[model samples]
Target: MMARTKGTANKASSQNENVVTLENPIKRGDTLIETITLIKPNAGTLRGVSLQDVATSDVNALIKVLPRMTYPSLTEHEVVNLELPDMIALAGQVIGFLSPTSVC
Candidate 1:
């Protein structure tokens, strides 16, 4: 698998946030089905909730809401890689994105 770095500027910081893209392992014929972005959760986002709380929350809700938030074009089957831990991490990342100041 190959990796490449992409950067985007966030209003909070003049420094570009580095986004790493990893080549998908699974494939359907010669075409790549889709690409997903992975964001590192900002620890400060978890105001009251512990990591365990985040992990134990209803993943089904995350599964439903995440596609709407990020990849609306991709179908359910396309998100097969997103398991419980992935969902929790995504939730944290999203919480950070929506309210950069604080999750509370």
Candidate 2:
């Protein structure tokens, strides 16, 4: 059996997440958040959002889903303020998460 290190569990779980570096950082209270990790959202996060919409890069779908998926979670308002490039990047990541190839 392979030996498990202290962060083995965290490392395993991190495989299901992707870190996105923002070209335009978000200011939350006193902090500027330059990167956000997008977790491979469970079914609960997809509720009330359409898979087709997410695949199509629908703005409403992004607003509805991002806060549920992002680490340092974005509010709907923050999602709205994302730059066009950032939004495109986010949409692409979300689409990738839906792909069967994303599973180990």
Candidate 3:
């Protein structure tokens, strides 16, 4: 887990904050579809996974990171079973939702 930073938001900064809204909001009583896809890595390959590889990689780091955002709602088991393309799509949605200003 990453350490949380402490800071106070100024009135102006807080007031002018940009919020990203989801098109399909996750509401109460909604049942999300569960699906899984599997991929096998080739032997003796030096290539590492990339965004394009999201369609084929056996393990996606992005999928693991999503649980940190969804928490109890999205368990490790659910994340591990997620399809590569689906994981990539979710990651894009998360990034779009957060609209981070900078990265550490």
Candidate 4:
């Protein structure tokens, strides 16, 4: 796992500010599919989650969304047992990414 931003450590910093800028811009057509394995927090045991499938071209939106997802709390049991809808619901609840986008 990556380290948390200094904004989270310092009291005076704003959490909403972008501290690290991306060197390359992720346009509307970029794609990334990562299969993240789950590990037990205390025991360091690897769970059976083989990588989840994610297909999205909205790179700009994903950058904002990915960081908010809960890391250590997600277990392999949750991923294997629950269906796609259930997983989506859980992710939305934990990450708060399901809010309606504003029309500009």
Candidate 5:
């Protein structure tokens, strides 16, 4: 195996801001970081998971919606499961999290 050159590491690090920084970062009051998961296009459509629905919920309710946004497809009684990728994108903004910011 080869070690990464110092120059290469610096260049890569500069390009990717998502990489954790070692220095002090700007802090905002009560700001929460959320991870937006990759959406599975193969999954079928499931409504009522949009950003509008999520934003209206109270903090506790929002907590419940958070897990479901990125959850994998599941089967119930042999029905094909659906993943909500679109909802992930929309809800990301509603919750003040950074979206993958890519259109699919």
Candidate 6:
């Protein structure tokens, strides 16, 4: 077994696959959000949301689950206000989180 090197940890943290840079930034109060970072969800984060729907990139399911997984904590209004391209990108990230990675 090998110990994780500092360089390896730095590289892993440098590329955050879940951060969505908005094509059109959304405003919350006076704050203008440029990027949204979504954390990998746990079972609790999926509460009241269907995994199948999320895996399928269902908009309604994503809308329900995103706020739980997102940083800077979005409101329902904010989530609903996401531009089409931004929403699509976010949906893709969500799907990636649910997908299995290669066991290299």
Which pairs clash (backbone N, Cα, C closer than 3 Å) in model 6?
none
Cα lDDT of model 4 by residue, 1-104, tens digit: 33321223121125422122222212222331122211112211212221221223133332323333323222333344434443444343322222345799
Looking at candidate 6, what is the lDDT of residue 90?
81
Question: What would the per-residue lDDT of candidate 6 be over residues 1-104, giving only the tens digit for each residue?
Answer: 33311111121235775677777877665567767787899999899888899999888898898889877677777888888888888888888888899998
| Position 81, candidate 5: lDDT | 18
- The local distance difference test score of each candidate is 0.42, 0.78, 0.39, 0.28, 0.31, 0.76
CA error at residue 90 for candidate 6, angstroms: 0.7
Task: Name the regions of candidate 2 deviating beyond 4 angstroms.
Answer: 1-17, 102-104
Return the TM-score for each candidate structure.
Answer: 0.39, 0.80, 0.33, 0.22, 0.23, 0.82
- Candidate 4 deviates by what RMSD? 16.8
Best model per TM-score:
6
Enumerate residue pairs that collide in model 4.
none
Q: Candidate 5 lDDT, tens digit per residue, 1-104? A: 33211212221144532222212212223432222232322112323344454446333334434444432211231111113342333344335432346698
Error of 1 at 88 (Å): 4.1
Residue-level lDDT tens digits of model 2 in 1-104: 33311212221145533666677878877677777777888989999988899889899999999999987788999999999988887787888888887456
Q: Work out how many backbone clashes candidate 3 has.
A: 0
Local error of candidate 4 at residue 42 (angstroms): 24
Backbone clashes, candidate 1: 0
Full ranking by lDDT: 2, 6, 1, 3, 5, 4
- By lDDT, the best candidate is 2
RMSD of each: 8.8, 8.7, 12.7, 16.8, 13.8, 9.3
Q: Tell me how candidate 5 scores on lDDT.
A: 0.31
Q: Model 3: residues >4 Å from true position, as ranges?
A: 1-61, 98-104
